[model samples]
Target: MLPKKVKKRASLLAITLLVTVIGIFFILKSLNKNILYFKSPTDIKNNQNINFDKKIRVGGMVKKDSLIIKEEEIKFIITDFNNEINISFSGTVPNLFSEEKGVVAEGKLQDKTFFIADRILAKHDENYMPPELKDIMKKNAK
Candidate 1:
């Protein structure tokens, strides 16, 4: 038979462990739902069975000369230096979006080669300059 104090301590320990485990489980579950995986065009091409139902992010450079702006829609291609995927967005894009710049588009893939973007994110470094501006700078410097 265990002493009353010992029995109380054991119960407390067990409750603490159970609570901690439940907390961890809930945290992990929430994180799993919120996490959006980033993939490249090549990855999508290689993995044909990737989940298309869940929202995802695709990151790569915008392919040059692949942008077409219509009255209400914009279409472009994202490339990972190996493969390219066509992306279409019907809303306004970020001001920094341009060809040859790094971009991350969040949405679901319509098919293996096409993506419908819900959001478009353009990322650049602190010292980043647009390619056209950079070219002009180089010519001026020369």
Candidate 2:
């Protein structure tokens, strides 16, 4: 038979370990819910399971001639050559945003073909220079 003091200490240690494990589980679950993963148009097409409620980012090149603006809202398509997803946004986009440019739209997926974006992020290459900077450089050269 184990001594009473040793038995008490062992039970306490077991309880502490269980509590720590449960706390860790909750933290990991919360992180899993909050983390937003970037997916390409082709990934969205090939993946069979997609969480519609969770916000996700779809990144790809803007399909040429797929941009449509109406008042404050804009609609465009993102394609990865193999597949494409339609993105709809209702806010002002960055000046760098245009057709045939790389873009990442953060929002929720309404379906396999349609996505409703809360934000649009335009991507530019390292060589990209802002218009103001370009003008300044040209003036300096003159």
Residues 42-74, candidate 2, lDDT per residue (tens digit)?
788888899899889998899999999999889
- For model 2, the stretches where C-alpha displacement exceeds 4 angstroms are 1-37, 129-142
TM-score of each: 0.66, 0.64
Candidate 1: segments with Cα more than 4 A from true spot: 1-37, 126-142
For lDDT, the strongest prediction is 2
What are the lDDT figures for the candidates, one per model? 0.88, 0.91
lDDT of 1 by residue, 12-78 (tens): 9999999999999999888973564578888788885788897889989999999999998899999
* Location of the lowest summed lDDT over 10 successive residues in candidate 2: 32-41
Residue pairs in clash, model 1 = none
Whole-structure CA lDDT of model 1: 0.88
Error of 1 at 27 (Å): 15
